[model samples]
Target: MIWLVSMYLSSMLFLVLGSVLNLGLSLLCLEKGLSWFIEWEIMSLNSSSIVMTLILDWMSFMFLGFVMFISSMVLFYSGSYMSGDMNVNRFMYLVLAFVLSMAFLIISPNMISILLGWDGLGLVSYVLVIYYQNEKSANAGMLTALSNRIGDVAILLAIAVFSGSGGWNFLFYVDNMPKSDSSWLVCFLIVLAAMTKSAQIPFSAWLPAAMAAPTPVSALVHSSTLVTAGVYLLIRFSPALESSNSRLMLLLLSSLTMFMAGLGANFEYDLKKIIALSTLSQLGVMMSILCLGYSQLAFFHLLAHALFKALLFMCAGSVIHSVKDYQDIRMMGGLVYHMPLTSMCMNLANLALCGTPFLAGFYSKDMILEVAFMSPINLVIFILYALATGLTVCYTMRLVYYTLSGSFNLGNLYSISDESSIMTSPMIFLSVGAIAGGASLSWLIFPCPYMICMSFMFKTLALSVSVIGGAIGYVLNMSAVSYELNSIKLYNETVFSGSMWFMPYLSTRGVSEKFLMLGELYQKVGDNGWSEYYGGQGLYFVLTKSSGYLQVLQDNSMKLYMLSFLLWVIVIFFSMI
Candidate 1:
């Protein structure tokens, strides 16, 4: 117990120290407009160098600082959340490994080095997801791992493509690389990889499924470490993507992802899954804006979202811990009366998610929507941005109505309270960030605010949508014993929207159903039927029968030996004659 406690304390301390150091370095780099590359040559083959490289810049340093800060808080939170588990030490180690993986990804610009971190994040996250060791966790872990493997394969392909350029360092190549088919292909692969990591559109099922993980791991994975890795990677690759047509596709897909996630969250009842879907929605906002060539805006949103999302998850964890492991928001009501502090933090986080004025989300999310409005985009993209933004608030309001308002529905014997100081401390710390992170990041990332000349109608459109969405969300969720079952009335639409447009089904069963059936047929016909006669089992039977005949011959060896001798003698006499 002491050892575990010490491990947690040390990790939190180390991460906090790293966070402070990186923040200072980021400020220094930003002030001087400086970047440094430290490269060590691993080998050289045919004029192409295989080198391990670390990149230090304002962007990398600031992102690293955020990652470390969140990691520290998560570690501190975990010390209480998993305090009773026998495998707390293992969990701590996995979380540390996860943080280390993100660190590697944040600092490396080389494809090879990035893959090391990228793959590490995927592998470590799988372990963390399955930390609970249940059927759901196992399935979720598998889905998460396989979905991310798509990105790993893409990075490998990019590396193979980059080999033609005589170097694997993408930092030096993203610009000034002559426009060519190879360059286009590399950009496409990079986008594909980023999509898989960020859980955009078709690749998005795993993010919600991964809520099967422990809440602390969810806080880490959903916030700064895993999900944002793709967005961060894209922010780095935005320069190259600018010239490629893939950015347009990314914009459309991310917009759809945002809309789908927000719609799904409205229908979701699971508290953790609701939050996970919101994370997905926020990720879409980042990706879409990045694709629109506002990488700084995307980066700013990423940092602000990280702070609140982590706080949100911690608050969710505290609530779950008190609620006897019940996660359905329908079962939670008037939680503010039972756990005031957690309820406050959750409300703060949700408000941030909704882009409430002056909050962290407002600083970045509102700006992204405005910038998107000003950009020359199709009507479809514009409507998507608008509806998705509204849906974000709608679901957030719905969640609050279900979990924080109304009457408590649990049995009288159940007692729920926020007594865990360790858990609430992190929540309190991140609440500060959730309130100020956006404005602070806005100032740091943009030396001067973005100036956009737009009509008044366009300026208020985002706010109008948000207000309408929130009102409808709260009013719709107000339930009574006499009320009609609207969800039942619109069953198909409910299922379609609630299931993320059946993306989880498509990603898992729809994709593998035919292949699984094929394998079953092969097992019956090949392994059990025809192959039994010609394959390994058949060979085994034939060898057994041959051995039996040899045994019979040996048993009758004396009589058989005499007959053979007589035949040999007769043959010898005929040859002599």
Candidate 2:
């Protein structure tokens, strides 16, 4: 216990020191930019004293704050979550590495540092996710690593494009972006890279799937700053957003994704899936806000969301742990009386997440909408995103209802109350932030009454939408109308009357939906091309055929490998000249 406590303290201290150092580094970036080496990742280039390096600025500070705040809170949360686990020390090591890598990634002035940090976070998170080593968890971690690598490839390509243009350092390119068509291409690739890391559309299938990991891992990644990498990238290069259509595309996709994810969360049965989807939705809102030219608002939203979400996630772990790990709301009911304190904490976090007035989430989320409303969006898109927010409230209330507000069916364990201070300390701290964060952002608030009233009016409008929508959903939920469609509905309702599992993926018009929804169509027209050719059958046959052929040619293949090895050695020997 003493060792665990010491570990937690040291980790927190490390995060704090790292954050402070990042600020000085940020100043260096703002001042020197392309010249700053910024703690090299691997190799070094020759440098001159006269070049302006170290160009750290507000953006860097904001990103550093995000990485440290989440990592520190994650440390606190993990202490409680991993209390009795045997491999706690190893877990702590990976978490620390993840934190260190993310910190370095943000403050990195060049591609080398960024890639190193990027890969480091990926590797560490993979280990953390599969910390249990269960078959299910291991597969999920692989997916996370695989998806993250795909994102990294896009980033590397963008770096290649940037480096080709004589901008090897990230700070130089971001602070002084080359206003060219090639830069636009680089920005596009960068956006692709960001979306993959952020789990934005087209590549967002991995997040909900990653719930197989330990809950603390979810709290760290989903609720923390890791998923906000895309937003940070866009904010860090606000100049790039101003220069290309890539920014507009990003905003459009983010809005669409938020609507889908929020609605999808409303339909999900698992507790973790809902939070995961909400994480995606919130990132969408943040990205959209940032794209519309409000970096500070996005930053504040990112901070506020991380705090409240982390608190709620730990509360979730408590609920699951106390009740023997029930994730589906259908199985959990009336937990409020047993775990009163945890319930209250979840309630506060949920309300704040719904952007209720006077909460931290409200201030940041509201500002995003305010900024968004000023920009042009179709009525359909507006109502959809607005409705998505409403759905966010409904599902959250549903979570509260099923988990805490319903009738208790299970036999009692030790009477559930507040968790230990070790657990609740971080949660309480975050809950305080959730409650107080609205007042913290100065740009959005003022001391005047009429203005306050106007703000109330706007909130009232949003609140009205949320309440009414939730009320309708609640009625539908209980009316027996939704009951028929609730069970195994995604595959059936998605397409083919229960054949495909496209629940969260919204259907589009024309050939795209038809091809996706109507696989039978392809079966009729191109059975070999669509089904057997691409669906593991062809690969299996090819592998079988290759194995037999290789068995017959094994002696010859060995000789070829030997010959090739000798030729390579000879080439190297010659090149030595």
Candidate 3:
């Protein structure tokens, strides 16, 4: 037990040191335009050899530094969060393994090695998602795993098609690939794989469901590690997708995902699920920016978002723990009076999420929106981006109103206090990062600022939308008023938004029910009915009748034997004549 506790502390220290070292390395690389890579041949194939390769450029180093920092905090928090469990040591080990998998993903420059990390992330995350070993956890785990399996399959197919390059190392050919049909197909498949990992559009259902995992896992995996893997892939392969038609398709789908998730977040009430949906919305933002040919900006947002989001999840976990495991925000109110520090952290994270000026989200999100406005995109894309930006503020304000302010809504108000030092300490550390990460990363990522030509109206569009959304959120959740909106009485609209447009039901039950019904029909009509009768029963009847005739012929019954002998003799004589 002592060793386990020491392990968490020691690992946290190691990660902190590593992060600082990597940060220096990244700065050097950025200044010098230097990249380091190492490769070793592992196996010899027909013409191409399998090799393990590691890459260290500005992007890889910076992302690695961020991942390690967040992961270290998550592990530190988990020591307190999971201390009561008997499997706490095992949990720590798994978390370490998960971090290592993410590291593998970050440094690998080859497709095959990337897949190793990719699949490792998926497998470890599935286990983490179902760590509680309950029915809900199990079901959510399956949903998470199966959704990612689509990406795995897509990657396998991509490898098969890309084999024409005579090797699986995409970094070498990404810039030199021929403009052929196979190349286009490979690009399309790569986008498809990214969509799955990032939980974009049709693949979006699994993310919120995965909130069934423990809170520390949620903080690490959903916020920083697993979810960002897809965006990183897109950022790496942006060169290949620059001119492909798939870029347009990605832009359309990702923008829709952004709008849909933001709207859904407004209607969602669960504390963790709202955060999960917010993660989804942010992912959409990253993907959309990547589609718009701004990979550096996308990567910048990815890092900034990771900092605040991990902080956000940790804060949410703190609140949930304080309220006796209650996750519904409707039941939580007046928490600010009791848990001051936690509420402050939550508010800061929420404000950052809303892209408040000078905060972490402001740095990257503002840049992305500004770039979007200046890009040669159609009005539909522009409008969706604007609306989604507004909706982000709207939902975040709604969450704050329900969870922190207003009267105490819990049935019995027990004395609720802040968490122990073990938990709050990590939250404090992340809160600092969430506050300053954007500005720091902005300087590091973009040495030269982005120049945009737009009207004053376009310049303030994001802030205006945020203001309007904040107003709407306040009015909708005012505790002083007893007014009810008749619009909410409309079951269909409410159900659609509240249920994320029924995405979870459609992805899980809708598909599963249809397939299950098909299986039943097959059992009744084909297997039990036709197959049993025609194949089994028909064969039994034919064999039984033949056996009966043979038995009669051989039974030595005098009349039967004599009749058979006479018929045979007559047939033989006629043939001879």
Candidate 4:
């Protein structure tokens, strides 16, 4: 009890202090238009040097503030969510380590230093994902770790490519780097690293799988830490991408990720997976927008999404806890009647996610959509952006209908209530941010408003799609007992979308099946077959048989040995004669 109290109080204190300090520093940097680079020489050799670098700028400060704030809430909430678990302390420590890794990544503008934090985030997140000690958790952790490992390798390759520049700090080189083969290689590597970390398409299967972790961790991972690291890194590397053709490729991949996630979420029923898919969708939005040359908007959305998404996850945690650990939306209904506060917060976060007017998502999402519409993007990208925006609302509305509006669906004996203040307190705290974070971040991020001059139809297109999507989503999910599900009618399409377009299969079994089969063949022909006959086993068999024959001769009587010796001597004499 004492340890738990100490952990909670200490985390809250740090959260409060960190948030205030970072916010103040961010404002000061903004006011002065300042960026401070502090370098400490670790060692110097002949004609070369090694140093650690830290950069303090408005972006770093602001991102740090958001991260610390959300982490504080998550830790506090974990005190209750994981209270019964025996390894609660271990969980708290892992969460802190995760925050530390993110902080390192946030403050370092150098690729070498960033890799330190980058690898740390990946390693720590794998540990966190597997915290539950179950097969699902283990598999999810492996997927998460291996997927991020690709990014780690890309970063290492980028570091090698960056060696030619004589400095590991990319901030100085990104804008001024000359166009060369090495430069393009470095850019491609950075983009690959970012895409994998951000869980962009082909690499996105791990994001939802990661929900196997504790829900509090999900709030932190999806909202601010693990997933956002990629977008944040790319924000720092935006200059490199801006000049390269890689931006087009990133734009296409990210937009597809966005559309796929949104579609997948609409078919998803698991509470946490729905939210996870939403996070992936939002990440795609950030990456796509950044690729379109609006890193600030991407950063703004990242911050705002962190706020509401954290709140959303916390609310989901509350609901999941109250419902006896059931995560299926089908198992939950009329939750508002039991946990009004939680339902309200969940709905608020959902609304914010949908980019409802004047909310945090609206300020950033609305601007991003407006900018995307006005950009010289092709028609396919435009259609994807528009449809994805609608699907966002579609899933939110579907979730709301199933969880909040339906009749009580749990077994009659189950009691559901949001009586845990330890958990609810964090939700309320973040609800304030969810409600106002967008507008606040908008004022701070964009000193000048985005000048989006589009026709009336185009301007209102997002709003129209959202409204129609929400209505359809609600009406479709709200079914009579006699009515069949549309999903049943469109089974193939539903399966594809719900399955993330078979990406998880492709990522896990689909990709591994052939390799696993090859391994089996090797085991049959080499390790167990040919190698057994001619390798160590075969040598052992030959030596064992020779030893047995020698033992037989030694065990023979002395008379037999003498007679054999006489016969051998006579034969030798006859041959000599």
Candidate 5:
């Protein structure tokens, strides 16, 4: 127990120190518009040498600082959350390994070195996801691991393609790739990899299912490190992608992911799953804006989203811990009266998520809308972006209504209260970040003016959506007819959205069932019939019959011995003649 406690304390201290160092480095890089790279040769090939490289720039340094900061807070929170578990030390080590993987990924600019970090993240995350050792955790871990493996395979393929460049350092030649169809194919593959990592569209099923992980893992992985890796990759490669033809496809798919996740969040009842879907929705937002060539805005939003989303998850964790693991929001209400600090934190995080004016989300999210309006995008993307933004507010408001308001529905409320200081301290710390991170990051990332020419209606469009969505969310939740109408008329749609548009089924059962049936058929026909008869059973019978004839010959009496000797003598006589 003392060892575990010391490990947690030391890990927290190391992260805090790292965060401070990186913050200073980030500020210096931003001031001078400078980047530093250090490389050490690992192997010398005939033409190209393999090397380990680290990159220090404003982007990497700032992101690293944020990751370390969040991770430190999460470690502190975990001390309380996992205190009773026998395997708390194991959990702490896994989280530290996770943070180390993220740090390696952030600092490495070379593809070869990046894969080290990339695969490490996938492996550690799978372990963390199944930490509970339950059937649900196992299944969710498999889905998460398999879903991310697609991205891992995509990265390996990309590395193979990039090998033709005579070096594994993508930062050097990514901008110089020939503008041909083959080059665009590479870009597409990179985007595909990014999509899987970021949970865009078809690859999105895993993000919500990963809620099976503990809330601290969710706060770290979903909010800042793992999911944002893809967006960060795209940001770094934005120069190359600008010339590729795949941006159109990326635009459409990312917009759809944003819309789908937002819609899904509204229908979700599980507290943690709801926040997970929100992370998915925000990831889509980052990806879509990155596709639109506003990577700086996307980066800004990514950092800001990380702050609030982590806070959101931690607040949700506090609520879950207090209620004895009840995660369904339908079972939670009047939490404001029982757990005021937690309720306050939850409300603040939800508001930040909704892009309420002056909050962290407002700074980046509003700018994204303005930029999207000003860009030369099609009407479809524009409408989807607008509707998705509205849906974000809608779901956040719905979450607030269900979890914080109304009557206390839990059968036992006596034991429910604000969590201990260890948990609430992290919540409070991140709550301040959720409130201020956007404005700070926005100013740092864009010191110059971000001028825009837009009409009054266009300027107010985002706020208008937020207000309308909030009103609808509240009215629907309060209405007596809503449940009856949902059951009678909109049952299918409700089920669809509630099930994340059936994406979990599609990715898991839909794919697994087909492969399983094929295996069964092969077992019955090939293994049991053809293979058994022709290979195993037939060979055994032939060998057995020959052995029996040999035995009969060997067991022969004097007559058989004389016959064999006579046959040998006849052969010798024929040869001599």
Candidate 6:
């Protein structure tokens, strides 16, 4: 308890201090960087002035503010919620690890610090994700760790490519580092990173599994702090995104991730799990906007989302506490009568999430749709995004209707009043923020005037769509219109058998040893496609599942055999030499 208290207090101080320092330093840096950027463009790459300016403009105060806000909120919420749990101290330590890591992530001037923070976060989150240490939680943590490591390799390559020629830093807006020759490789690697972190497509399986952690952990991880790490990467490398060869595929991936995940959230019955899936979808939407060159909107939505979604998850936790362990909304009907305060908070949050006008969701999401329309991608993508907006409304309405409105039907389960002030207060605070979050509020370093106008226009569009969509959704939930889009279920059926198409040759070793030699060796082979006889999927799958059988000799004889083989290979090399 002492360690936990000390950690929380230290973290709180860090957050308070960091927010102040970031505001002053980052804003000053951005202005300096911007001025230098203009001069660099005029003076050309040969001038030494480029290096001077590179130091100033490489980061943003607004982004730092985000990092601080998210880290602080996660810490505060975790401290309060996990107080009585057995592993409270351990959880607090992990929370500190994340805060330290995430702080490093935003301020990281070059790729090295970025990679360090990224790796640290991946490691710590793995521990936190499996905090319960049960079979299912362990499996989820392993999967998250595996996916994170896979993405980490791509970042490592990006660092290598940048160091080789791009002067080890982005001195200008368009510092074409990997050069046009390696554009494909760079794009491919970045896309891989985004896929893993943002929970896009095939890599998305790990996110749903992450819900095995505590609710507060889930609130922090799923809402913004970790899941949106990919978006942070995208924003950081916005300059590089333009250089990718597979622009169309990357764009499609983003849009598809957004629309498809929205559908999945609808099908999910568990309140928190639904929010988790929705988090994945919203991130995809943000990426799609970023890919379309809409930075302001993306940043705004990231903030708006943090406000509402985190609140929703926290409120869900409250409901669970009140009921003593029910997650599925099907098991929780008509709670509005029982827990009126909780119900009101959820309703407000759901309204915002559904993108209704005058709400935070409307403002950020509208801009995404607006910017996406300007891109030359398929019109079908826009239609898909629009339909997702509808689905977002429908599903959120379902949540609101089932959990809060209509009846107080826990099906004869004894009703309980709003129990704890600790839990309900956060929801109330967040609800207030959700209602007024985008209402002409000025951020310290961000252009308040520009943001306010942009937010208004975006909110108008979002509100219009959400209300219309919500009406239709309400009809469907009430059996007024019975249509299940089933888009979420589509990917499962299609990717079922064909998923084994991408198997990668791991090393020069025989089929047996090829499966060993750690993670790096495997990533290398994945990058270089060996479409030959042995490296193909069918045979590799058979070899890997049976890898346990190959351990054979536990004696020193095995070591002697390896030593002899090495000596023989060396002698052959000398003879050749």
Lowest lDDT block of 10, candidate 1: 478-487
> TM-scores, in order shown?
0.90, 0.77, 0.89, 0.90, 0.90, 0.75
Instruction: Report the lDDT tens digits of candidate 6 across residue range 1-577.
Output: 6777777668866875876676566567655654232212323353322231222232455555555655565566666667778877777767767767766665555555467678888988898889887998897787778767778998889766655454435433235644567656666777788778887765776777788888877877766678877887777667667656555676787777767766666656778778876787788788888777666567678778877887788878878777767887767777877888987888777777877678878766665676565567677887777777877887788777667764555656565778666567557766777888755322432454453344555435555666777786666566622366443457675343122111111111322244455555755666344433446665777787667445443344767689879999999999999
Residue-level lDDT for 228 in candidate 2 = 72
Ranking by lDDT: 4, 1, 3, 5, 2, 6
How much lDDT does each candidate structure score? Answer: 0.91, 0.71, 0.89, 0.91, 0.88, 0.68
Name the runs in model 1 displaced over 4 angstroms: 479-483, 516-577
Candidate 5 has its poorest 10 consecutive residues by lDDT at 480-489
lDDT of 1 at 112: 92
Q: What's the CA error at residue 373 for candidate 4, in Å?
A: 0.5
Q: Write the per-residue lDDT of candidate 2 for residues 445-476, one digit (tens) a residue.
A: 23232332245655466778779766765665
Lowest lDDT 10-mer window, candidate 3?
479-488
lDDT of 4 at 129: 93
Which model is ahead, 2 or 5, in terms of lDDT? 5
Per-residue lDDT tens digits for candidate 1, residues 282-316, read 99999988988889889999999999999999999
User: Model 3: residues >4 Å from true position, as ranges?
Assistant: 411-413, 479-488, 515-577
Q: For model 5, how does the per-residue alpha-carbon lDDT over 349-400 read when each residue is reduced to its tens digit?
A: 8899999989999999889899989999999999999899889888888888
Q: What would you estimate as the lDDT of candidate 2?
A: 0.71
Task: Tell me how many residue pairs clash in candidate 4.
Answer: 1
The C-alpha stretches of model 4 lying farther than 4 A from their native spots are: 44-46, 480-483, 516-577
